[model samples]
Target: MRSMTLGLLALTLASACGRNTPRPAARADAPPCHCSHDASAPMAANQPLPDTSVFQMGVPWTDQSGRAFDLASLAGSPTVVLMFYGTCQSTCPLLVRDVKRVEAALSPAARARTRFLLVTFDPSTDTPERLSALAAEDHLDLSRWTLLRGADHDIRTFATVLGVQFSRVGPGEYTHSNLITLLDPQGVVATQLEGLQQPVEEFARRIEGYTR
Candidate 1:
């Protein structure tokens, strides 16, 4: 069953993340499905995670604060998740900035209950200390944002679950898909915003519904 779940997800992602061309900046007119869930409702607390939940990976992780972390603990709050390395010279900086824009757009009520999770593709370079330093450099609100790294295999598994393709292109460098995903309170992927430099108002609005 687990293998089947992963297989189906891989197929779904092949279409979503396989595109070589950059997806266009998100517009108000963009398809609603981009910010909507395939499931009709969030799962109840006692319910097992659906096959689509990334939290199903059950991998051990370490956060920027150097604390051991569990992915499932993120349940019960909406989370914004993305994958990137700290030192990338190209799209990573812009991707982080775009996520911040969405964060800034959320109302305090919504923002308080929301979490931002940034996991690194290059775990060897993005140690907890380095992730913390990068967070400080970006002025991330530590109370809400979490930067995480894990063992290489765990990182690969987690990336696969999120449909984020990444590869080490050179020493200290990686190429990765620019995908921002929103997980519902139950940790099921509710929607995604792809590409870079996209408008964030609609994305922010979609997230607000989950917070409330």
Candidate 2:
């Protein structure tokens, strides 16, 4: 009777052990809790970066110096392009200031590798010389900064390709996105920085990475 009782007890223990297996504890390698990005988040990274989207530079547009410039000439390398109007009192200045901040944040190595390109939607007014002055006023180093202009048609075309939108409000005043687009060495847009709130660190990282 004792031997029979012991056998039954061992059988019950073996059955319980078979039913339960030890599980590994939760760890950092575990998948993050599933979550979605904000539905209303800006469409900043919506598309794959391209080498060169679309640019029209060869056509005649008066620069600030009143000399005609061809947009095609500025192609080939990575560019940080932004859209602007000369007479804007709001975002344009701030946009330039933000660019200046990015410039100041770059290491010497990055300074030599990247270029800042500004194209004016208000081609009628932002002559090359005026644009040059604007760059100087904002403390932009011309060694790597190139301001270009195109006829209204070319400007519209460039903006369309860049997905940049600007609306003219008053004589010389326009409301536009404070955007900075990163183009790869081939002229394809890698990313666009929308809004001035993004940190200069982010700018440096994006520029450094894209240009690299």
Candidate 3:
């Protein structure tokens, strides 16, 4: 009976060990995002929607022109902020391709009124010179797709607020989220596209909503 009891205890301990998992604490963003707004909430089901573009991060950094820029930037018109590295192997290119597609679909007047901001996460490698070259290679209009850089801390902060996720595996290589954020002229996140699988028409529609 003692031997049986010992075996049962060992089995229970093994089961408990196998079932253990490190649970993460509730994050600040975990709570449903709500504010005192007369409009509507930005959450649908379990996901966040940009009902109002009031979210802004004041983190500061520099632009491709080597001028100071910040997350709380005020664009002349509403803007679409995108994240990518010059040396990205996959998703980044797809994002740019989709943006171009959207641009092509836009009316000449709409293209003139909207803006795009590309923030580089790998700022150490993507200096102003390299960013310039990459922009040229992609035929990016500096007037529209403005490239920006930030130090690691501020860059991470900006990425977090935009919900852009990334992990560096080696030098100049990263696994990152394929996301694009639409910010209104007032500098609020109007909406965020979490994946690149959506149609360019979808992005165009989203952009129009923000422009209004």
Q: Judged by TM-score, which candidate is best?
A: 1
1 against 3, candidate with superior TM-score: 1
lDDT of 1 by residue, 1-212 (tens): 54355535655666577568344432353223322552334446776765666776789999998899898887767889989999899999999998999899999988887899999988889988999999999999999999999998998898777778888889898988899988877676767888898888876877778765
Off by over 4 Å in 2: 1-52, 55-76, 210-212
Worst 10 residues of 2 by lDDT: 33-42
- Model 3 steric clash pairs: none
Question: Residues 1-212, candidate 3, lDDT per residue (tens digit)?
Answer: 54354535665565565436322322344323232241122222333334443334556667777888654444335577788898998888888876677778677776776777888989999998988888899999988778888888977877777778787888999888788776655545655666775666755665555443
Q: What is the lDDT of residue 61 in candidate 3?
A: 68
At residue 47, give the lDDT of candidate 2.
Answer: 40
Q: Rate the local accuracy (lDDT) of all candidates.
A: 0.81, 0.64, 0.68
Measured by lDDT, the strongest candidate is: 1
Candidate 2 Cα deviation (angstroms), residue 96: 0.6
| Model 1 spans > 4 angstroms off | 1-47
Q: What is residue 63's positional error in candidate 1, in angstroms?
A: 0.6
